[model samples]
Target: MEKISSENPSIEKTKFIKSKGLKDKPHNYCPGCGHGIVHRLVAEVVEELGIREKVIAVAPVGCAVFAYDYWNFDVTEAPHGRPPAVATGIKRILPENFVFTYQGDGDLAAIGAAELIHAANRSENITIIFVNNTVYGMTSGQMAPTTLLGQKTLTTPHGREVLRDGYPIKVCELISVLDGARYVARGSVTTPKNVLTTKSYIKKAFLNQIENKGFSIVEILSMCPAGLDMEPLETMEWVDKELIKYFPLGVVKDV
Candidate 1:
Protein backbone atom coordinates (compact mmCIF):
# COMPACT_ATOMS: atom_id res chain seq x y z
CA MET A 1 0.00 0.00 0.00
CA GLU A 2 1.21 3.50 -0.77
CA LYS A 3 1.97 5.53 2.31
CA ILE A 4 -0.62 8.28 2.90
CA SER A 5 2.05 10.97 3.21
CA SER A 6 3.86 9.78 0.11
CA GLU A 7 0.63 9.56 -1.82
CA ASN A 8 -0.18 13.19 -1.05
CA PRO A 9 3.10 15.04 -1.19
CA SER A 10 1.21 18.11 -2.43
CA ILE A 11 -0.13 18.47 1.11
CA GLU A 12 3.35 19.50 2.21
CA LYS A 13 3.93 21.63 -0.89
CA THR A 14 0.62 23.42 -0.46
CA LYS A 15 1.98 25.18 2.61
CA PHE A 16 4.27 27.22 0.34
CA ILE A 17 1.82 27.86 -2.50
CA LYS A 18 -0.37 30.87 -3.12
CA SER A 19 -4.10 30.56 -2.47
CA LYS A 20 -6.35 29.77 -5.41
CA GLY A 21 -9.60 29.80 -3.47
CA LEU A 22 -10.30 33.50 -3.98
CA LYS A 23 -12.16 34.46 -7.13
CA ASP A 24 -11.01 37.27 -9.38
CA LYS A 25 -14.30 39.13 -9.03
CA PRO A 26 -13.87 42.04 -6.65
CA HIS A 27 -15.65 41.60 -3.34
CA ASN A 28 -18.68 43.83 -2.73
CA TYR A 29 -17.76 44.64 0.86
CA CYS A 30 -17.40 48.30 1.75
CA PRO A 31 -13.83 49.56 1.65
CA GLY A 32 -11.97 48.73 4.91
CA CYS A 33 -14.61 46.19 5.88
CA GLY A 34 -12.55 43.56 7.68
CA HIS A 35 -14.72 40.73 6.33
CA GLY A 36 -12.86 40.75 3.03
CA ILE A 37 -9.51 40.47 4.74
CA VAL A 38 -10.70 37.68 7.03
CA HIS A 39 -12.14 35.84 4.02
CA ARG A 40 -8.79 35.97 2.29
CA LEU A 41 -7.01 34.72 5.38
CA VAL A 42 -9.42 31.79 5.68
CA ALA A 43 -8.95 30.92 2.02
CA GLU A 44 -5.18 31.03 2.41
CA VAL A 45 -5.31 28.85 5.51
CA VAL A 46 -7.47 26.24 3.77
CA GLU A 47 -5.06 26.23 0.86
CA GLU A 48 -2.07 25.87 3.15
CA LEU A 49 -3.75 23.03 5.00
CA GLY A 50 -4.49 21.32 1.66
CA ILE A 51 -8.02 20.55 2.73
CA ARG A 52 -9.81 22.63 0.13
CA GLU A 53 -11.30 19.57 -1.54
CA LYS A 54 -12.48 17.83 1.60
CA VAL A 55 -13.61 20.92 3.41
CA ILE A 56 -17.22 22.00 3.73
CA ALA A 57 -18.07 25.62 4.46
CA VAL A 58 -21.49 26.67 5.69
CA ALA A 59 -22.19 30.23 4.65
CA PRO A 60 -24.59 32.20 6.82
CA VAL A 61 -27.27 34.45 5.40
CA GLY A 62 -25.79 37.87 5.93
CA CYS A 63 -23.19 40.03 4.22
CA ALA A 64 -21.06 36.90 3.91
CA VAL A 65 -23.81 34.97 2.13
CA PHE A 66 -21.75 34.99 -1.04
CA ALA A 67 -18.74 33.41 0.60
CA TYR A 68 -19.38 30.18 -1.26
CA ASP A 69 -18.59 31.97 -4.51
CA TYR A 70 -15.08 32.72 -3.32
CA TRP A 71 -14.13 29.55 -1.50
CA ASN A 72 -13.22 26.64 -3.81
CA PHE A 73 -14.79 24.00 -1.64
CA ASP A 74 -18.07 22.28 -1.02
CA VAL A 75 -20.37 24.89 0.44
CA THR A 76 -23.94 25.09 1.63
CA GLU A 77 -26.15 28.00 2.48
CA ALA A 78 -27.75 28.15 5.89
CA PRO A 79 -30.68 30.22 7.02
CA HIS A 80 -30.03 33.46 8.86
CA GLY A 81 -28.57 32.69 12.26
CA ARG A 82 -28.47 28.96 11.56
CA PRO A 83 -24.90 28.31 10.45
CA PRO A 84 -23.96 26.75 13.76
CA ALA A 85 -26.83 24.29 13.66
CA VAL A 86 -26.01 23.49 10.06
CA ALA A 87 -22.34 23.05 10.87
CA THR A 88 -23.18 20.78 13.77
CA GLY A 89 -25.25 18.51 11.56
CA ILE A 90 -22.69 18.48 8.76
CA LYS A 91 -19.76 17.66 11.06
CA ARG A 92 -21.72 15.00 12.88
CA ILE A 93 -22.66 13.29 9.64
CA LEU A 94 -19.35 13.60 7.91
CA PRO A 95 -16.76 13.41 10.61
CA GLU A 96 -13.91 12.97 8.15
CA ASN A 97 -14.48 16.21 6.35
CA PHE A 98 -13.49 19.57 7.76
CA VAL A 99 -16.59 21.60 8.59
CA PHE A 100 -16.67 25.32 9.24
CA THR A 101 -19.20 28.11 9.59
CA TYR A 102 -18.73 31.72 8.63
CA GLN A 103 -21.17 34.17 10.19
CA GLY A 104 -21.68 37.85 10.91
CA ASP A 105 -22.17 39.41 14.32
CA GLY A 106 -25.92 39.84 13.99
CA ASP A 107 -26.34 36.32 12.78
CA LEU A 108 -24.12 34.69 15.40
CA ALA A 109 -24.65 36.77 18.49
CA ALA A 110 -28.26 37.81 18.13
CA ILE A 111 -30.61 35.56 16.23
CA GLY A 112 -28.28 32.58 16.51
CA ALA A 113 -27.16 32.92 20.09
CA ALA A 114 -28.79 29.71 21.18
CA GLU A 115 -27.33 27.74 18.31
CA LEU A 116 -23.85 29.15 18.86
CA ILE A 117 -23.89 28.51 22.58
CA HIS A 118 -25.36 25.05 22.24
CA ALA A 119 -22.94 23.97 19.54
CA ALA A 120 -20.02 25.15 21.57
CA ASN A 121 -21.32 23.47 24.69
CA ARG A 122 -21.74 20.22 22.79
CA SER A 123 -18.11 20.39 21.70
CA GLU A 124 -19.07 19.79 18.10
CA ASN A 125 -16.12 19.06 15.86
CA ILE A 126 -16.44 22.24 13.88
CA THR A 127 -14.67 25.53 13.37
CA ILE A 128 -16.48 28.87 13.34
CA ILE A 129 -15.21 32.17 11.92
CA PHE A 130 -17.30 34.88 13.55
CA VAL A 131 -17.07 38.37 12.09
CA ASN A 132 -18.19 41.15 14.41
CA ASN A 133 -18.67 44.40 12.50
CA THR A 134 -21.25 45.82 14.98
CA VAL A 135 -23.89 46.48 12.32
CA TYR A 136 -26.20 44.52 10.10
CA GLY A 137 -24.54 45.32 6.81
CA MET A 138 -26.64 43.37 4.33
CA THR A 139 -29.82 44.47 6.05
CA SER A 140 -29.03 48.16 5.94
CA GLY A 141 -27.05 48.94 9.09
CA GLN A 142 -29.24 47.78 11.91
CA MET A 143 -27.78 47.56 15.38
CA ALA A 144 -26.26 44.21 16.16
CA PRO A 145 -25.70 42.55 19.52
CA THR A 146 -22.07 43.51 19.31
CA THR A 147 -22.80 47.13 18.55
CA LEU A 148 -20.99 49.39 20.97
CA LEU A 149 -22.76 51.62 23.43
CA GLY A 150 -23.74 55.00 21.99
CA GLN A 151 -23.13 53.87 18.40
CA LYS A 152 -25.82 54.96 16.02
CA THR A 153 -27.22 52.70 13.33
CA LEU A 154 -30.27 52.58 11.11
CA THR A 155 -32.20 50.86 13.87
CA THR A 156 -30.79 53.09 16.56
CA PRO A 157 -30.87 56.48 14.90
CA HIS A 158 -30.15 58.26 18.17
CA GLY A 159 -27.28 55.91 19.00
CA ARG A 160 -27.48 52.78 21.14
CA GLU A 161 -28.72 53.82 24.55
CA VAL A 162 -27.33 51.92 27.50
CA LEU A 163 -30.69 51.99 29.28
CA ARG A 164 -32.45 50.31 26.37
CA ASP A 165 -29.82 48.22 24.52
CA GLY A 166 -27.17 47.60 27.11
CA TYR A 167 -23.51 47.20 26.13
CA PRO A 168 -21.95 45.17 23.35
CA ILE A 169 -21.72 41.45 23.86
CA LYS A 170 -18.22 40.14 24.32
CA VAL A 171 -18.68 36.81 22.55
CA CYS A 172 -15.18 35.45 22.97
CA GLU A 173 -15.30 36.00 26.70
CA LEU A 174 -18.75 34.48 26.88
CA ILE A 175 -17.81 31.40 24.90
CA SER A 176 -14.53 30.99 26.76
CA VAL A 177 -16.51 30.43 29.91
CA LEU A 178 -18.02 27.31 28.36
CA ASP A 179 -16.29 24.04 29.18
CA GLY A 180 -16.81 22.40 25.77
CA ALA A 181 -15.04 24.98 23.68
CA ARG A 182 -11.47 23.91 23.04
CA TYR A 183 -10.31 27.23 21.67
CA VAL A 184 -11.73 30.74 21.48
CA ALA A 185 -9.88 33.81 20.27
CA ARG A 186 -10.67 37.38 19.27
CA GLY A 187 -8.78 38.71 16.27
CA SER A 188 -8.90 41.55 13.75
CA VAL A 189 -7.93 42.44 10.18
CA THR A 190 -7.34 46.12 10.82
CA THR A 191 -3.67 45.96 9.66
CA PRO A 192 -1.32 43.63 7.83
CA LYS A 193 0.16 42.44 11.11
CA ASN A 194 -3.25 41.73 12.54
CA VAL A 195 -4.26 39.95 9.35
CA LEU A 196 -1.28 37.62 9.67
CA THR A 197 -2.16 36.87 13.26
CA THR A 198 -5.76 36.18 12.25
CA LYS A 199 -4.57 33.68 9.67
CA SER A 200 -2.47 31.86 12.25
CA TYR A 201 -5.46 31.64 14.58
CA ILE A 202 -7.66 30.30 11.81
CA LYS A 203 -5.12 27.66 10.90
CA LYS A 204 -4.84 26.55 14.50
CA ALA A 205 -8.62 26.35 14.78
CA PHE A 206 -8.82 24.15 11.71
CA LEU A 207 -6.07 21.88 13.04
CA ASN A 208 -7.87 21.56 16.33
CA GLN A 209 -11.04 20.50 14.53
CA ILE A 210 -9.12 17.87 12.58
CA GLU A 211 -7.72 16.55 15.80
CA ASN A 212 -11.25 16.42 17.24
CA LYS A 213 -10.17 18.78 19.96
CA GLY A 214 -13.69 20.31 20.12
CA PHE A 215 -15.60 23.34 19.00
CA SER A 216 -13.43 26.37 18.22
CA ILE A 217 -14.32 29.92 17.36
CA VAL A 218 -12.36 32.96 16.24
CA GLU A 219 -14.28 36.22 16.67
CA ILE A 220 -12.89 38.88 14.34
CA LEU A 221 -13.63 42.52 14.99
CA SER A 222 -14.17 43.85 11.48
CA MET A 223 -14.91 47.27 10.05
CA CYS A 224 -17.98 48.39 8.10
CA PRO A 225 -16.92 51.61 6.45
CA ALA A 226 -20.09 52.27 4.46
CA GLY A 227 -22.31 51.54 7.41
CA LEU A 228 -20.16 53.66 9.65
CA ASP A 229 -20.06 56.41 6.99
CA MET A 230 -16.33 56.78 7.31
CA GLU A 231 -13.49 56.74 4.82
CA PRO A 232 -11.48 53.53 4.56
CA LEU A 233 -8.40 54.88 6.33
CA GLU A 234 -10.43 56.51 9.03
CA THR A 235 -12.39 53.33 9.54
CA MET A 236 -9.17 51.43 10.10
CA GLU A 237 -8.00 54.08 12.54
CA TRP A 238 -11.30 53.78 14.35
CA VAL A 239 -10.72 50.05 14.65
CA ASP A 240 -7.35 50.70 16.23
CA LYS A 241 -8.60 53.33 18.68
CA GLU A 242 -12.29 52.88 19.36
CA LEU A 243 -13.12 49.30 18.46
CA ILE A 244 -10.09 47.86 20.17
CA LYS A 245 -10.94 49.76 23.30
CA TYR A 246 -14.19 47.86 23.55
CA PHE A 247 -13.03 44.56 22.07
CA PRO A 248 -9.44 44.31 23.19
CA LEU A 249 -7.24 42.18 20.94
CA GLY A 250 -5.94 38.74 22.00
CA VAL A 251 -6.82 35.09 22.52
CA VAL A 252 -9.51 34.95 25.13
CA LYS A 253 -9.28 31.19 25.61
CA ASP A 254 -7.40 28.18 24.20
CA VAL A 255 -7.61 24.73 25.59
Candidate 2:
Protein backbone atom coordinates (compact mmCIF):
# COMPACT_ATOMS: atom_id res chain seq x y z
CA MET A 1 0.00 0.00 0.00
CA GLU A 2 1.50 3.30 -1.13
CA LYS A 3 0.89 6.53 0.76
CA ILE A 4 -1.01 9.14 -1.20
CA SER A 5 0.64 12.56 -1.14
CA SER A 6 -1.81 15.34 -1.81
CA GLU A 7 -1.73 19.12 -1.35
CA ASN A 8 -5.40 18.93 -0.33
CA PRO A 9 -5.52 18.02 3.40
CA SER A 10 -9.18 16.99 3.14
CA ILE A 11 -8.30 14.08 0.79
CA GLU A 12 -5.41 13.02 3.04
CA LYS A 13 -7.77 12.80 6.02
CA THR A 14 -10.07 10.60 3.95
CA LYS A 15 -7.45 7.85 4.07
CA PHE A 16 -9.11 6.53 7.19
CA ILE A 17 -12.79 6.30 6.53
CA LYS A 18 -15.37 4.98 8.96
CA SER A 19 -16.31 1.32 8.72
CA LYS A 20 -19.68 0.92 7.07
CA GLY A 21 -20.57 -1.97 9.35
CA LEU A 22 -20.76 0.27 12.45
CA LYS A 23 -23.03 3.26 12.89
CA ASP A 24 -21.62 6.62 13.98
CA LYS A 25 -23.71 7.12 17.11
CA PRO A 26 -23.62 6.97 20.89
CA HIS A 27 -23.25 3.51 22.52
CA ASN A 28 -25.34 2.36 25.45
CA TYR A 29 -22.73 0.05 26.99
CA CYS A 30 -21.33 0.88 30.43
CA PRO A 31 -17.87 2.33 30.89
CA GLY A 32 -14.96 -0.14 30.80
CA CYS A 33 -17.08 -2.72 28.97
CA GLY A 34 -15.20 -4.88 26.42
CA HIS A 35 -18.26 -5.01 24.15
CA GLY A 36 -17.11 -1.82 22.41
CA ILE A 37 -13.79 -3.34 21.41
CA VAL A 38 -15.43 -6.54 20.23
CA HIS A 39 -18.01 -4.56 18.28
CA ARG A 40 -15.27 -2.60 16.48
CA LEU A 41 -13.40 -5.77 15.65
CA VAL A 42 -16.51 -7.35 14.15
CA ALA A 43 -17.20 -4.26 12.10
CA GLU A 44 -13.62 -4.12 10.84
CA VAL A 45 -13.79 -7.79 9.83
CA VAL A 46 -17.03 -7.19 7.94
CA GLU A 47 -15.44 -4.29 6.10
CA GLU A 48 -12.32 -6.29 5.31
CA LEU A 49 -14.34 -9.27 4.06
CA GLY A 50 -16.52 -7.00 1.89
CA ILE A 51 -19.65 -8.89 2.98
CA ARG A 52 -21.45 -6.04 4.67
CA GLU A 53 -24.32 -6.11 2.18
CA LYS A 54 -24.75 -9.86 2.49
CA VAL A 55 -24.37 -10.07 6.26
CA ILE A 56 -27.30 -10.59 8.62
CA ALA A 57 -26.70 -10.63 12.36
CA VAL A 58 -28.91 -12.46 14.88
CA ALA A 59 -28.90 -10.58 18.18
CA PRO A 60 -30.33 -12.35 21.21
CA VAL A 61 -31.44 -11.03 24.60
CA GLY A 62 -28.54 -9.84 26.76
CA CYS A 63 -26.24 -6.82 26.80
CA ALA A 64 -25.89 -7.21 23.01
CA VAL A 65 -29.60 -7.37 22.21
CA PHE A 66 -29.59 -3.79 20.91
CA ALA A 67 -26.62 -4.42 18.61
CA TYR A 68 -28.80 -3.45 15.71
CA ASP A 69 -28.73 0.14 16.94
CA TYR A 70 -24.94 0.18 16.85
CA TRP A 71 -24.33 -1.76 13.66
CA ASN A 72 -25.02 -0.16 10.30
CA PHE A 73 -25.92 -3.48 8.66
CA ASP A 74 -29.02 -5.61 8.95
CA VAL A 75 -29.80 -7.33 12.25
CA THR A 76 -32.69 -9.31 13.74
CA GLU A 77 -33.59 -10.04 17.35
CA ALA A 78 -34.01 -13.58 18.68
CA PRO A 79 -35.62 -14.87 21.83
CA HIS A 80 -33.35 -15.24 24.82
CA GLY A 81 -30.77 -17.95 24.13
CA ARG A 82 -32.27 -18.68 20.73
CA PRO A 83 -29.73 -17.04 18.38
CA PRO A 84 -28.47 -20.33 16.96
CA ALA A 85 -31.99 -21.44 16.02
CA VAL A 86 -32.77 -18.02 14.60
CA ALA A 87 -29.54 -17.89 12.58
CA THR A 88 -30.25 -21.36 11.22
CA GLY A 89 -33.65 -20.33 9.90
CA ILE A 90 -32.34 -17.12 8.32
CA LYS A 91 -29.38 -18.89 6.65
CA ARG A 92 -31.61 -21.67 5.36
CA ILE A 93 -33.95 -19.13 3.86
CA LEU A 94 -31.14 -17.12 2.25
CA PRO A 95 -27.98 -19.10 1.85
CA GLU A 96 -26.36 -16.15 0.15
CA ASN A 97 -26.54 -14.09 3.32
CA PHE A 98 -23.64 -14.30 5.77
CA VAL A 99 -25.39 -15.12 9.04
CA PHE A 100 -24.00 -14.79 12.55
CA THR A 101 -25.11 -14.70 16.17
CA TYR A 102 -23.91 -12.27 18.84
CA GLN A 103 -24.60 -13.66 22.29
CA GLY A 104 -23.29 -13.57 25.87
CA ASP A 105 -22.44 -16.39 28.25
CA GLY A 106 -25.77 -16.28 30.09
CA ASP A 107 -27.73 -16.44 26.86
CA LEU A 108 -25.47 -18.78 24.90
CA ALA A 109 -24.05 -21.16 27.52
CA ALA A 110 -27.01 -21.24 29.91
CA ILE A 111 -30.42 -20.72 28.28
CA GLY A 112 -29.49 -21.46 24.65
CA ALA A 113 -27.12 -24.33 25.31
CA ALA A 114 -29.28 -26.93 23.60
CA GLU A 115 -29.89 -24.79 20.55
CA LEU A 116 -26.17 -24.10 20.06
CA ILE A 117 -25.20 -27.74 20.53
CA HIS A 118 -27.77 -28.95 18.01
CA ALA A 119 -26.75 -26.28 15.54
CA ALA A 120 -23.13 -27.35 15.71
CA ASN A 121 -24.11 -31.02 15.57
CA ARG A 122 -26.12 -30.38 12.42
CA SER A 123 -23.31 -28.32 10.82
CA GLU A 124 -25.17 -25.07 10.29
CA ASN A 125 -23.26 -22.68 8.04
CA ILE A 126 -23.25 -19.76 10.41
CA THR A 127 -20.89 -17.94 12.74
CA ILE A 128 -21.29 -17.46 16.50
CA ILE A 129 -19.59 -14.62 18.40
CA PHE A 130 -19.82 -15.71 22.03
CA VAL A 131 -18.76 -13.17 24.64
CA ASN A 132 -17.96 -14.66 28.04
CA ASN A 133 -17.65 -12.04 30.76
CA THR A 134 -18.07 -14.56 33.61
CA VAL A 135 -20.94 -12.68 35.26
CA TYR A 136 -24.19 -11.54 33.73
CA GLY A 137 -23.68 -7.84 32.96
CA MET A 138 -27.18 -6.65 32.17
CA THR A 139 -29.04 -8.51 34.93
CA SER A 140 -27.25 -7.26 38.05
CA GLY A 141 -24.07 -9.33 37.81
CA GLN A 142 -25.48 -12.77 38.32
CA MET A 143 -23.35 -15.89 38.11
CA ALA A 144 -23.08 -17.09 34.51
CA PRO A 145 -22.37 -20.61 33.27
CA THR A 146 -18.82 -19.51 32.46
CA THR A 147 -18.17 -17.87 35.82
CA LEU A 148 -14.99 -19.18 37.40
CA LEU A 149 -14.93 -21.31 40.52
CA GLY A 150 -14.52 -19.37 43.77
CA GLN A 151 -15.37 -16.13 41.97
CA LYS A 152 -17.99 -13.95 43.60
CA THR A 153 -21.00 -12.47 41.84
CA LEU A 154 -24.25 -10.85 42.91
CA THR A 155 -25.96 -14.24 42.91
CA THR A 156 -22.92 -15.88 44.49
CA PRO A 157 -21.99 -13.46 47.25
CA HIS A 158 -20.03 -16.17 49.05
CA GLY A 159 -18.22 -17.10 45.85
CA ARG A 160 -19.04 -19.86 43.38
CA GLU A 161 -18.73 -23.22 45.13
CA VAL A 162 -17.26 -25.95 42.97
CA LEU A 163 -19.14 -28.73 44.79
CA ARG A 164 -22.51 -27.03 44.61
CA ASP A 165 -22.21 -24.99 41.38
CA GLY A 166 -20.40 -27.68 39.41
CA TYR A 167 -17.78 -26.41 36.91
CA PRO A 168 -17.70 -23.68 34.32
CA ILE A 169 -18.63 -24.91 30.87
CA LYS A 170 -15.78 -24.78 28.33
CA VAL A 171 -17.80 -23.72 25.30
CA CYS A 172 -15.01 -23.87 22.73
CA GLU A 173 -14.04 -27.33 23.92
CA LEU A 174 -17.61 -28.53 23.82
CA ILE A 175 -18.36 -27.13 20.36
CA SER A 176 -15.09 -28.35 18.82
CA VAL A 177 -15.97 -31.94 19.72
CA LEU A 178 -18.88 -31.86 17.32
CA ASP A 179 -17.91 -33.35 13.93
CA GLY A 180 -19.89 -30.71 12.04
CA ALA A 181 -18.00 -27.79 13.56
CA ARG A 182 -15.37 -26.53 11.13
CA TYR A 183 -13.78 -23.95 13.36
CA VAL A 184 -13.80 -23.16 17.10
CA ALA A 185 -11.49 -20.96 19.15
CA ARG A 186 -11.22 -19.00 22.42
CA GLY A 187 -9.54 -15.59 22.78
CA SER A 188 -9.47 -12.54 25.03
CA VAL A 189 -9.21 -8.74 24.75
CA THR A 190 -7.23 -8.10 27.92
CA THR A 191 -4.06 -7.08 26.09
CA PRO A 192 -3.12 -5.45 22.79
CA LYS A 193 -1.51 -8.63 21.45
CA ASN A 194 -4.48 -10.66 22.62
CA VAL A 195 -6.85 -8.22 20.93
CA LEU A 196 -5.07 -8.77 17.60
CA THR A 197 -5.22 -12.52 18.06
CA THR A 198 -8.95 -12.23 18.85
CA LYS A 199 -9.45 -10.34 15.61
CA SER A 200 -7.68 -13.12 13.74
CA TYR A 201 -9.88 -15.71 15.39
CA ILE A 202 -13.03 -13.79 14.57
CA LYS A 203 -11.93 -13.37 10.93
CA LYS A 204 -11.37 -17.10 10.58
CA ALA A 205 -14.76 -17.92 12.10
CA PHE A 206 -16.51 -15.56 9.70
CA LEU A 207 -14.51 -16.91 6.76
CA ASN A 208 -15.62 -20.45 7.60
CA GLN A 209 -19.24 -19.45 7.08
CA ILE A 210 -18.56 -17.37 3.98
CA GLU A 211 -16.70 -20.28 2.41
CA ASN A 212 -19.56 -22.62 3.34
CA LYS A 213 -17.31 -24.78 5.50
CA GLY A 214 -19.89 -25.32 8.29
CA PHE A 215 -20.40 -24.19 11.88
CA SER A 216 -17.77 -21.87 13.39
CA ILE A 217 -17.52 -20.10 16.74
CA VAL A 218 -15.16 -17.76 18.58
CA GLU A 219 -15.70 -17.43 22.32
CA ILE A 220 -14.26 -14.17 23.63
CA LEU A 221 -13.26 -13.67 27.26
CA SER A 222 -14.35 -10.10 27.84
CA MET A 223 -14.02 -7.71 30.78
CA CYS A 224 -17.01 -6.36 32.71
CA PRO A 225 -15.82 -3.77 35.19
CA ALA A 226 -19.30 -2.61 36.18
CA GLY A 227 -20.49 -6.19 36.73
CA LEU A 228 -17.41 -7.04 38.78
CA ASP A 229 -17.63 -3.77 40.74
CA MET A 230 -13.99 -3.03 40.05
CA GLU A 231 -12.04 -0.21 38.43
CA PRO A 232 -11.44 -0.51 34.70
CA LEU A 233 -7.76 -1.28 35.17
CA GLU A 234 -8.50 -3.73 37.98
CA THR A 235 -10.95 -5.57 35.77
CA MET A 236 -8.30 -5.92 33.06
CA GLU A 237 -5.80 -7.29 35.55
CA TRP A 238 -8.41 -9.65 36.98
CA VAL A 239 -9.14 -10.99 33.50
CA ASP A 240 -5.47 -11.79 33.05
CA LYS A 241 -4.98 -13.27 36.51
CA GLU A 242 -8.27 -15.14 37.01
CA LEU A 243 -10.52 -15.35 33.96
CA ILE A 244 -7.89 -16.79 31.59
CA LYS A 245 -7.06 -19.59 34.04
CA TYR A 246 -10.41 -21.28 33.56
CA PHE A 247 -10.83 -20.31 29.92
CA PRO A 248 -7.36 -20.70 28.50
CA LEU A 249 -7.03 -18.90 25.19
CA GLY A 250 -6.32 -20.95 22.04
CA VAL A 251 -7.75 -22.50 18.91
CA VAL A 252 -9.70 -25.49 20.19
CA LYS A 253 -10.55 -26.82 16.70
CA ASP A 254 -10.24 -25.61 13.13
CA VAL A 255 -11.02 -27.97 10.32
Which parts of model 1 have CA positions greater than 4 angstroms off?
1-18
Question: lDDT tens string, model 1, 51-101?
Answer: 888899999889899887777778899998999999999888888899999
* All candidates: CA RMSD (Å): 7.3, 4.5
The CA root-mean-square deviation of candidate 2, after full C-alpha superposition on the true structure, stands at 4.5
**CA-lDDT, candidates in order:** 0.88, 0.92
Give the range where candidate 1 is weakest over 10 consecutive residues by summed lDDT. 10-19
C-alpha TM-scores of all predictions: 0.91, 0.93
**What is candidate 2's lDDT per residue for 73-191, written digit by digit as tens?**
99999999999999999999999999999999999999999999999999999999999999899987999988888889999999999888989999999988889999999999999
